[model samples]
Target chain A: MWLLKLAWKNMWRNRNRTAITIAAVFFSVILSILTNSLQDGIFDNLIKNVVSFYNGYIQVHKQGYWDEQILDNTFEGTSALEDSILALENVNALAPRLESFALASSDTLTKGCLVIGISPEKENSITELKNKLKEGEYLNEQDFGALIAEGLAKRLKLYLHDTLVIIGQGYHGAMAVGKYPIKGILKFGSPDLNDQMLYLSLPAAQELYGAPKMLTSYVVGLENPSNLDPTAEILRDKLGNEYEAMTWEEMMPEVVQHIRTDKGSLVIIQGVLYMLIGFGIIGTLLMMMVERKYEMGMLVAIGMKKRKLMQLMLIESVFTVLSGCILGMLASIPIVFYLNRYPIKFKGELAEVYEEFGFEAIFPTSTNPEIFLTQGLFVICMALLLSLYPIVKIARLDPVAAMKK
Target chain B: MNTVIDAHQVSKTFNPTTIPILAVNNVHLHLERGEFTALVGPSGSGKTTLLNLLGGLDKPDKGSIFINGVDITKLSPNALIDFRLNNIGFVFQSFNLIPVLTARENVELIMQLQHKDRREINERVETLFREIGLEDKLDTRPAQLSGGQQQRVAVARALASKPQFVLADEPTANLDSKSATNLLDIMAKLNQEENITFIFSTHDVRVIERARRVITLVDGQIHSDTAKVSTEVPHTAQKRTP
Candidate 1:
């Protein structure tokens, strides 16, 4: 233990060298923490927007309906489907929705849109579509009321009280048309959705589309988002071939794939950055060893054993790494916390690019505390691993050659 | 008398890139317990090489080397390290005290490797530091002390281990005239009072005059062995004797 203290003191003998080495480690640690925390936060926000807006962790639809999603491919005669699924242990909320496209017209203007029919209470419960109303009330449960996207409302020159005409093909081979007063102008984040989606009462939708008793797929919710697979399986067995239980996974396959690829690439990037940091530390340690070679030889000449010399080298490395790592970790906390609270915003072209793809432009680092702990551990551990090369080199050092220099 | 160090025809060769040179050729020497022996030779006469062979830091190419009756030449590298740690102390021309360690910690370094209790190491180091008249310099690092003080710390370190022999190679080469004399006097006194054998290789006249016995080497061989008759000391009351 005393020998180790001597080794630690030896490293600090060259003050500027020790400080430079520590600074390198400290900067690397800070960069790693920032990059990782931001990556985690961005990925999480994308997932939350997709899941909370429409797909409720998992979704349930008829088999093959996921791929086709046409009105004719929905669950037709699964009368016991809802009751059977609700019996599951973790099933929280489920809402059946009918989705289709139509051309909306306001006398002089015409635009294509995705028109959706939903049970007012159930849709309200799942997506809080009711709270998304910017200008008017939610679609009335007992009466015919419709929610139109802000972009769609603009093109049609439709106000909250203005009537708009929607035309499309019904469940069968017949034309469906309807004129309804716009109850609300809803903004559902993504500009694409803001330009295309319209929500109407389920009964009004069935009457207009000529699919009276027929409906569309269900959007299911679970107690915990992580338990999506198990809940989806039970629903699949109960509904059989008449329906398929599709989780958020199938709905947002591209999003999930993006997250996986992003994580893999970030790991490689952080790994390379840390490798560079390790090399910097190794360079410093090697320099220290070279400078102290004669002194080390003298120590052994004055009765220090090779084993004790090796211990001293290791102790020096540990001290250097620990000081930097602890300082770096301490410094990261407030910076990450402040960034998490107040996100970064991009305007103009960058904003438009994200909006075009149905994403938020402003990014916030995740508030998850694991971001700090996990990154801190990774940086500290890599630094320690880098320390090994110096110790090994010292252990194999020849005291005689050391003294000659 | 018990022989503290014994070597028979010890030869050391350094394998350079293109040629192997024999540094210490066919040399044999022994130091009895409590005796001060000087192995004197000019530079490149292989005095330090022979010292290394005796200290087990380097191996003889073609001969057996023993310390306190044990054939250290046959020991493995790790065993040789343990051997040196337990049975031998070294003082170098440069003093070789660790620059980062205080005077007492420098003395305690070997005993630390021996894994002695902290209390025992402290007491022994303290005793040795006091004997060297550096009790106030116990907390001073080698770099902080003068050349003479550094040598005194080295002597204390050598004595702290209580080894059977100390191998000193030009120990006072870096000190001033007074420091060299004072250090030699302490070492001579310690050799007499403690009965610890000290073997040195030097070109210094003061060391030669103070040494009880001297062995001269040249061209990789011992050229002469002589006993000195000191003109300075009174023979009647030699309180400390080897």
Candidate 2:
């Protein structure tokens, strides 16, 4: 108890020095927490944009269809299968799509494009497709009119209510051709998707393709996208071998790889930051040891063992660092909360670059408790590791020579 | 007379490779219980080095040092620290009390290091502070206390563990005449009344004049050893009640 008191008093002997050391630790912790929080928040937002905006958290397709993607490989969209999946917990909505590549032609331009068929109401519930309409109106179940993307309309020089022809190969080597008026023009954040996509009602597409009651894949939405893995497992088990269920992470491994690579680079940056923080703490410790050389010698010469002295120094350092960590955490809470609520909007080139990748150009901080706690613990461990300097120095101190100094 | 400390042909050298300085030559000495002795010499004559050797603060290059029959030079570094904590006390010329601690806390530190019971530590600190005329300044830190007061606190801290002897290295070197005299009086009284042994290394005539025995060093060897004849009662003959 008295040793604690002594350590406390000693730490305050040079108030300015102690305060500066503590401030260094405090600010470093805040920077580290904020950096990690912002990075996590941005990645999470990216996932929501790329996956949940339309791709769905998980998808079910015919076993050979994913590899071949031909109309002959399509399966029947059975009510029993839909009901079984919907009955399982966490399955929010499902949209069945019949997709194929075809030639889209207008007055002067003929473009190779992707043709998609959807049930308007079911697709609306899952992907909120109706809200993406930039011109005219959303599709109805019986309507044979097509929904063309804004980029594709601009390339074709077509207007709303313009006639367009879609030509493609149908199932079993049948020739597929269709003529429909453009009912709507939809906008998309990604230029790749916007320049090539076309949507039609399910029955209209089945008639044109000459294959009734057929679907390429069922896109399944979930209550939480993070729960995709376990939900996909349950769905796969119920569906048996005819179909394969895959999460977005598996279906879009490129996106997952990009996030992983970025996180790896971030780890290296954080390691450098930690090294700077460690060296700052070590510098202060070295100064402190030099200043208290005589006092340490006197204590030892008066029969205080070196181990006891080492213990006292260790206690003092821990107290200082823990105090700094707690203060840093307290100071960061409000800043992080405010930043999360009102994210920083980016403009100019960066905004355009983000739009190109189909992400919102805003910076948001995460409010995860783990970010604060794990970062705080990491900085504290660094402080403890730097304390080894004093321990080794004291253990090897020559008391008689120190007293003379 | 019981020998409290025995030094057998002790020697110490400094900068042995370049300008080899023999700090303490081969010398033999013995101290009895309850004796107030002083080692006096000119500058660079190795009085302080000899004191360090006898107090176990420095090791001898050539011979063994025994305190109460245990050869301290043979003990490990950790064991030597334990030995010093229980058997030897130290007082420095600059009054080296830890500046961050209060006078009472400084005195209690040694006893605490000894792992003494709380009640015993409190009792001993109280008595020693009072005995050294520092009871009024018990809570004062060294920085807040005068030089004389700091030295008194140092003395009290040294004796708090009730060691076999106290080694004071020029304790009065930094005090004014009045403060030095007062400090000497306190130390002299403690020796006479409590039968505590004190060995000091000093160039101060005031301190040497008050010593019952003086050992003078010249060129790292004892030049003369003399004892003063007392006209009054031998102070140690009078029994003290604690």
Candidate 3:
């Protein structure tokens, strides 16, 4: 108890030095936390945007269908299968799609395009497809017309209400052909999707492809996207061997690879930041040791044990470091949350660059409690590690020589 | 008479490997209980070196020192520190009181290190402060106290743990003539009334004059050990010198 009092008093003996040390730790913590929060936030937002724009959080396909996406790999769409999937806890909604490539033509132009068949209202609920409609009316259950991507319509020189022709091979080498009025022109954030997508109502597409009651894939919406992997696993197990449920991370390895590479770079940056924090703490501790040499010699001469003196120094360091870390965390709470609420938007070329990659051009911060705890604990450990210098100095000190100094 | 300290063939060398300098060479001494003694010499004559050897602050390159019948030279470093805490007190030339602590806290520090009971520590500190005539300066830190008052507090601290003896190295060198005389008078009174042993290494004539026995060192050897008849009696009734 007496040692504690002495340590506390000693820490404040030089207020300016102590305050400078604490401020260094304080600003380091805030910078580290904000950097981590922003990195995680940007990646999370990218995943959310990619998943919601077209593919739902998880997809269920017939066995071997993802590997060979042809009309032959399509499975019969069953209401019982949909009911059983929707019964799961995290499964919010499901949309069944029949998709294949066809050659599209109008008047004097022709282009290769992807034709998708969807149940209008169910697909709208999952992907919010109606919101992307830029011209003409959206598809209905009875409508025989199709929705063409704006870029695809421009390539074919077709307009809304114009007649369009599609020709492709059907299931079992059968001939498949269709002619329909373009009911809507849809715009997509991704240029690749906008250039080649043509959407048809479920029954109309089933008839045109001569594969009635078949679906290529089932898009599963989730209540909590973070539970996507586990939910997909549960659905896969429940559906048995005939189907395979895969999360977006499994289906889109390119996106996952991008995020992983970015995270690796961030780790290196964080390492550099922690190193600077360590040096700052070490500098302060070095100054303290030099200043207190004479006093320490006197204490040792007066029969204070070296072990006790080391303990006193450690307690003083802990007081300084813990106070700085706690204050930094408290100060960062509102700033991180404010950034999360109102993200920083990019302007001009940066905004265009983000859109080019089919992503929103804003940076938000994550409010994960783990980021705060991990960063705070790591810095505290670093400061404590550097405090070993004083203990070693005291252990080897010669009282007579120190007093002379 | 109880032998409070005994030094047998004590010697210390500053740099034995290259250009060696012998600080204290083959010295022998014994201190009895309640003796007021001064180890006096010119500069670089090994008075302070011998005092450090006796106080267990440094170990001799050769020979053994016994305090209260235990040979301290044979003890381990940690054990030496514990032994010093229980049996020896120290006062430095600079009045090296811990600057962060108040005068009362400084005086209470040694007793606390000895793990004395709370009430006993308080009572002893109060008595020592009164004896040193600095009862009113209890709460003042070392920086706020005059040189005389600070040295008196150092004396009180040295006696707080009831050690077998006190070792002071040039304790009055930094004080004025009046402060040095008052400090010597207080130490002399403590020796006379409580039989507390004090051994100082100093060149000050005032301290040497008040000491009952004076041991003079020349070239790391004892030149004279004289027990003179006391002329100046310890005047406890004198007013506190500020």
The lDDT of each candidate is: 0.79, 0.87, 0.88
Lowest summed lDDT over 10 consecutive residues: which window, candidate 3 chain A? A45-54
Predicted structure 2: lDDT: 0.87
lDDT score, candidate 1: 0.79
- Model 2 alpha-carbon miss at residue A289, Å: 1.0
Quality class of the docking in candidate 2, CAPRI style: medium
Q: Give the candidates in order of TM-score, highest first.
A: 1, 3, 2
Top-down DockQ ranking: 2, 3, 1
lDDT of 1 by residue, B1-242 (tens): 49887789888878756587878889878778998988777788888888888998878888898788899999977787778878888888888777767887788877887888989998898788778888999888788899999998888888777888898989988899999999998999898998889998888878878888877676677766667634332232122221
What is residue A188's positional error in candidate 3, in angstroms? 7.2
Runs of candidate 3 exceeding 4 Å displacement? A79-95, A100-210, A221-241, B229-242
lDDT of 3 by residue, A1-405 (tens): 998999899989999989998898899999999999999889877775677667788888898887888899989989999999999999989999888999999998999999999999999988889988999999998679999999899999999999999999887778889999999999875666788889999998898899999998899989988887789889989999999888888888888998999999999999999999998899999999899899898888888899999999999999999888988888888989999999988989989887777677888999998888888998899889999999999999888888994
Better of 2 and 3 by TM-score: 3
Of 1 and 3, the candidate ahead on TM-score is 1
In the predicted model 2, the residue pairs found to clash are: none
DockQ of each: 0.50, 0.69, 0.66
lDDT of 2 at A258: 79
Model 2 Cα lDDT, one tens digit per residue, A108-184: 78998888899988888887888789999999987899999998989998889999999999867898899999999
When sorted by lDDT, best at the front, the candidate numbers are 3, 2, 1
Pick the lDDT winner.
3
